[model samples]
Target chain A: MQIELVYVPIDAAAVLSGVKAGEDGAVTVFDGIVRNNTKGRQTRYLEYSAYEDMALDQMRALGAEAIQRFGVRNVAMVHRLGHLEVGETSILIAVASAHRGVTFDACRWLIDTLKQQVPIWKKEVFVDGAVWAPGEPFPAEIALG
Target chain B: MRLEVLFFGVLRDRFGERETLAQFPGNSVADLVRYYRVIAPELGELWSSVAVAVNQQYSRASAPLQNGDQVALLPPVSGGSFRNIHAD
Candidate 1:
């Protein structure tokens, strides 16, 4: 399992190469990119920030859980911080397994869970103004106070 | 006790990045949160939605605090794509 929060652009080819092996039949990848607009508002750019150490810890835990829960052979997840322009990949997820079904399932679950549980945040810079993108509520158990 | 307090996202913008509270009167995470709410009453409803973390772990409001503990006040994390555009 590999998990990282990086400042530079995410290299999808390099990450995919590292995860694939001869034994794996399918390698599923989820590439999340910055879009040109959000809800019809034109986006100028985006800035992502993370509670570095804590975010990494949470991401690593997600990768481990994906492996265990889906029985995938390997998992790699990376998210980029700092400035991101439209068309730039913001986050990447790769899952390798002997079969395709579990690979796809694991990849989806990883991204969904990470978005909710991880301590990373993004600010959307729109044509009109900038606002911290409203976040999904924490899972009931995690939201204590 | 002295504790390090960190804020993130919207909270960071409102309260800066981090502050050191020396001789903090709080005994638990809830107490520290209440103290912040009193000083920045303008925050109002935002305080009730924040989640607390102690030493990088998700902590309960009743979690006890000690000297040198690192506490974080986290707004709901905005990791995925944008949803509601009109939010302040």
Candidate 2:
């Protein structure tokens, strides 16, 4: 189980190396890079923030869940905080398993659930202006609003 | 109870304070939100849309509060919506 939240620029090769193993037949990675545009607007950069303590705990839970639900050998997740320039990797997830099917499923599930349950937030900086990226509504069960 | 209310994302920008320590006159998270809304009406209706996190977990409005509890107001999260990125 490997889960991390960092402020430094993400190194893709370094992340990939963590999951590379001789016994594992397949490794699936999800590289969440910052794009240059959003909804046709030219974006300059992005800023990510999180409630650090809780965010890390939630991420660890997600990694554990992926291991159990998908039968993956190991899971690694890293999300960068603070300012991020366009094309920089903002988040990365690497999942290793004996087969390709579970690796893909766990990798996808990790990212999707991270967006939903984790406390991290992102703000989009546009060329002309800036706005906090509109996020999906919380599930009715946990929503306070 | 003295509670520290935390703001993140747009809420931080709106409140103009990253975190504020205040005496919450009520006992639950809902009371705290209502109490602060009066003091800072500038937050307006946006106050109602935020999700509350008690000590880092997504908490319901009626969740009871204790002195020194760290309550965070969270806006919507857009982290995984990166276009041209490998999410799926």
Candidate 3:
């Protein structure tokens, strides 16, 4: 139920707290962080940008889908924008459900779907150069000509 | 009509700007591409593989565009990774 596109570092603890519910038996979190290298190149940092309005809308859709598909009670997703250093959290997803199994399944589904569908881009700055990381193509239905 | 087109990631770098206001002569996304080709040929090469978003949703090249519509050229999404605790 909480979806944000933030420039500041993601507060994973705060996001997790938002997903807490007394009735939910389990909560699963997927925390994505910035790494130090890509394909053997030493990364200096990363710059993330988004079609912000669209990205937020797409994220909201993902959270809603998780609720409908997996019967999860709450879904919290936060994605960071702007520059980030190594070891910084980039994205976080927390899913609460009545059972542990559904929580895990929903958490996985949310991140996977967000990666493919959301209009967010990241560029890796290596010591030698900076390049945009090639991403997976969108599904046929949503892809433009 | 004038359309405000946004460029992101590599596209932003290619255009050397984040957003632009374009004078669109045609109605569809393809028309916008054609217009851009005349002004910036380099962008044509990159446009072939990009996905266009209209009003914050995935849109097709054939989708009609109106004045003041917000169109964004999305290169690709390199997000959401668990490998080595980082993003791609």
**Winner by TM-score:** 1
The residue ranges of model 1 lying beyond 4 angstroms of the native Cα positions read B82-88
Q: Which ten residues in a row have the lowest lDDT in candidate 1 chain B?
A: B79-88
- lDDT tens per residue, model 1, A5-118: 899999999999999899999999999989898778899999999999999999988899999999999999999999999999999999999999999999999888888879
True contacts kept of 2: 0.62
Candidate 3 chain A has its poorest 10 consecutive residues by lDDT at: A136-145
Candidate maximizing DockQ: 1
Question: Candidate 3 residues B1-88, lDDT tens each?
Answer: 7777888878787675445566657899888766666776765546666788887778888999988998877776777754423334
Give stretches of model 3 more than 4 Å off.
Answer: B18-22, B37-45, B82-88
Per-residue lDDT, model 3, residue A44, is: 93
Docking class of 1: medium
Clashes of 3: 1
Evaluate model 1: give its lDDT.
0.89
lDDT of 2 by residue, A81-133 (tens): 99999888889999998899999999999998888768888888888998877
lDDT of 3 at A41: 83
Per-residue lDDT over B1-88 for candidate 2, one digit per residue giving the tens place of the 0 to 100 score: 7787888878778675456566557899898778768877886756766788988888898899998898888876656545523211
Indicate whether candidate 2 or candidate 3 has the larger DockQ. Answer: 3
